[model samples]
Target: MQITVNKTGGFAGVNQRLGPVETSSLDSGVADQVRRIVTESDFFHLPEDLQGAPVYDGFHYAVQVLDGTAEHTVILAGMSDDPVVARLHELIHLLDEAVGFQWI
Candidate 1:
């Protein structure tokens, strides 16, 4: 499995890309964390587009997950109130920390 995260449109307007990282390449704990987050967020069940209205100076996130023949993509606005969005944000932040980028 592979997961990719692209973050854009923050207050600094800086765009960041983190991984097409394979789950097997990560530490066992990190891989488990990623799996738990994906499962808890129900990421595969979410719509492909999740941009809610939009907010000034808010960030935009694009997450893609590939598991064998299945692939899911979700685009979200930073300030969305949805629980899924909140979970995604948290997952992205965790990934950023793991990868040594503070773009979130």
Candidate 2:
């Protein structure tokens, strides 16, 4: 599986992007965790447009996931306590750690 995260609309209005990273290249444990989440998540079935917190000057995330021939892209404008957001947050965190990027 491959994952990519693009963050925009933060306080500084900066644009940041991370990966087309392959889970196979990650540490065994981290990769496993990511794969498990994707497997158990409704990620693949989510709407392409997703609303999150909607905070002013907050961040927006464009998270794209690809597995085999399946691909999905979800964009969150702001953040919320929604389970999907939480799951994406966790996934982003793992990706952040994997690539040495910070999301907050």
Candidate 3:
């Protein structure tokens, strides 16, 4: 399993990419969390674009997941009230802490 996170459209106008983070190379706990998050959040079936409150200086997130059975991406605004979006946001934070390759 692999996951990539891209954060863009922020105050500084700088874009960042986080992985293709290989689950095999991560700690078991973190890797398991990724699997659980993807499954429970229905990551694969989510709409590709999840537009949010659209704050002018807010960040945008693009998360791509590629596991053995499927591949999908979800893009969302940083500010939102949706539960699923919140979950994805948390997942991004988790990745940032556990296997980060870029600044958030």
Candidate 4:
């Protein structure tokens, strides 16, 4: 499995890309964490876009996951009322932290 995260459109207009990292090579615990988030967030079942109207200073995230021949992508805003959106954001944030990136 592989996962990639691209973050853009924050207050500073920062754009960052992390991973395309291979989950199987990651520490078992971290890989498990990623798997748990993917399952709990129902990431593969989500729409291709979750973006709403742009909010000034709000961030946007695009996440992609690949497992075997299957692939899924989800884009979401910085804040949302949808539980899946919130969970995906949390998952990405946790991943960023795990990879040593400062949280936004």
Candidate 5:
């Protein structure tokens, strides 16, 4: 999986860069988990309800599952306070790159 980090404006703005993550090379473990989640998740369900302390004070998350695609997105603040959460987020993005929503 190639995690591309694109740096946006800095020294003036918040240095926000919504980099693109391509998840092509997926290990068996991650691949299996993602497949299971996709199958089990409520496709008819509404957007996940996230109610808690915001990951980023001003930033909001916008996640989308590509239509007719298997790629699922969980957009949250850049990173989470917990390392595990951050890692999981990146891992999901990698899944997005690997098996897109098409295969689903």
Candidate 6:
């Protein structure tokens, strides 16, 4: 699994990261566990909106999910008190890889 996180536009102590978890690389059980942990979650509870919300220090978070890949961008004018928000974004990407909907 390749995971990467970049910290920007936030308070000095805030942290952010992202990664690509290869489902083919994980053991079936382990992969299943990861899948269970990550899924389509609600961002409404977060301190921002999907289209426009402050994430950190005059920034916002834009999340993009794809098969075997997830990308995130922190928009300025954002502030995040909770650290897990970033982790959750990465997890959501993994979930999409694990068992996300697809059109074929």
Judging by TM-score against the true structure, name the best candidate: 3
The full ranking of all candidates by TM-score, starting with the best, is 3, 2, 1, 4, 5, 6
Candidate 4 clashes between residue pairs 3 or more apart in a chain or in different chains: none
Between 2 and 5, whose TM-score is larger? 2
- How many residue pairs collide in each prediction? 0, 4, 0, 0, 6, 18
lDDT of 2 by residue, 22-85 (tens): 9999999999989877777778998888886478988778999999999999988775767777
Q: TM-scores, in order shown?
A: 0.85, 0.89, 0.91, 0.84, 0.35, 0.32
- Residue 37 miss distance in model 5 (angstroms): 2.2
How large is the C-alpha RMSD of every model relative to the true structure?
Answer: 2.4, 2.5, 1.9, 2.8, 8.4, 9.8
Off by over 4 Å in 1: 101-104
lDDT ranking of the models = 3, 2, 1, 4, 6, 5
**Residue-wise C-alpha lDDT for candidate 1, range 1-104, written one tens digit per residue:** 79898878868896878887788988889889888989988888999988987688887778999998989999988456788887888778777877744444
So what's the TM-score on candidate 6? 0.32
| CA lDDT scores, all candidates in order | 0.83, 0.84, 0.86, 0.80, 0.41, 0.42
Give the alpha carbon lDDT tens digit for every residue of 1-104 in model 4: 78888888877887888786787877888889889989887778889999876788988788999988889989887446887777787778767766744334
Model 1 clash pairs are: none
Candidate 3: clashing residue pairs, number:
0
Q: Which ten residues in a row have the lowest lDDT in candidate 6?
A: 43-52
Best by lDDT: 3
For model 3, how does the per-residue alpha-carbon lDDT over 5-68 read when each residue is reduced to its tens digit? 9988867985888987988888899888878888899999999999887789888888999988
